[model samples]
Target chain A: MMTLLFILFATSMWLGWHGKRKPAIFVFLVTIALCAFWFKHHATSELHIDL
Target chain B: MTPTFARKLNVIFLIMICIPLIGAYTIQFGRGEFPCPLCLLQRLAMLGIACGAMMNVRYGIRASHYGMCMISAVLGACISTRQILLHIVPEPGNTGYGSAVMGMHLYTWALLIFIATILILGVVFLFDSQFESKEATSKTRSVPALGAVAFWLAFGITVANVCTTFLECGFKQCPENPTSYLML
Candidate 1:
């Protein structure tokens, strides 16, 4: 999961540096979506823990 | 907006980020309260954005804008990650010290506000292109250098505090239960 996040983050950083606004935004949005999905899945399962 | 107006807006943004941080600290030290994992993440994110905004205001928009956006994006990711972590892994072993607030209801509100602020900043950065203006860009490079220094200083102090708190009370000594409500 961390690796996926790092990849997304690195992609966004690359897009930003290259002045590719749309791609950067897309990457950020994708990161947010993945995070939300994982969070929901974790929250519903028995292993889910709230801090 | 004129350069002057942009500068003012940058300052305003910085203050927006700082006020809550100071309030959070007061609540933590003065009120003897501790923040949870999500809360700590939010504080860290806010600090990053505040530093970026402060530098933009002090220098110029062109130099600091990309850096600010990057910082905002990083912060947004951190806060979002913390929230997900809390919801998915609520066990004692997964928790960190000073990650849970001991008393008062306002901390939750603060957390929500902090998260929203980071997200908004990230979105703003996504659409902003003013920083790329050739004339303004050259004048703004120095801003980020100074901002980076300040960011490290603030981050250093925050880490030191967290370290001290962790040493004083291991994770086992802190609250095991999660907050009953979700701020988001």
Candidate 2:
């Protein structure tokens, strides 16, 4: 899950750097969605601690 | 560099400012070293400055310089005042707030950098001076922007790596049997 977040973050950052603002924004939103999903699922289940 | 090029440079400057701040978090969380009050204060100031710089890049040079200076001033004053107090008192009982209340290492290098940042922002704010005004026209601004961006990019990536390390380590405590240093 963390890895996925990192990948998404990297993708968004790359998109932003490459001057694709719309895609970058989309990627950023996707990253946030992934993070939320991860938090709701694996974060608590794996870490056993509320983040 | 061209004016458009300079605007891009401003973005880089913002990235540079993010580096150390991220490093400090890494040092604290990754290394299990807790941040003292002054350290936290400095971090807060740096965060504000970084955000301001990012905003400036998102907007323009004039906006970035002014916004950064304003935010830096607030954080700088808080950290600087704390440092001055630490230097004067240098007693655990004299400290205020969290670990600061217990007193911790002064981290003079960090303080120095904070001071330097304040000074740099001051100069940036004064960019309206005759010399700076001449430089602000289309062509000259690009060089500074480019330099600023390069600096920020290097700084940001370095610090972000540190932050990543901290997230991995996931520790919340300062070192046991910690050493306390006098501020002076």
**Which candidate achieves the best DockQ against the true structure?**
1
TM-score of chain B, per candidate?
A: 0.54, 0.52
lDDT of 2 by residue, A1-51 (tens): 333444454454454444454564465556545433432342121212233
Candidate 2 stretches with Cα past 4 Å from truth are A1-51, B5-9, B87-107, B126-184
Candidate 2 shows a clash count of 6
Model 2 per-residue lDDT at A5: 41
lDDT of 2 at B82: 46
Worst 10 residues of 2 chain B by lDDT: B175-184
Give lDDT tens digits, candidate 1, residues A1-50.
42244345445534533445456557655665664454344333243444
Best by TM-score: 1
Number of the top lDDT candidate: 1
- How well is each residue in B57-155 modelled by candidate 2, as lDDT tens digits? 433455434444355545445555545544554466644323331144334545565667677666655544312242342231223555446445634
Chain A TM-scores, one per candidate?
Answer: 0.71, 0.73
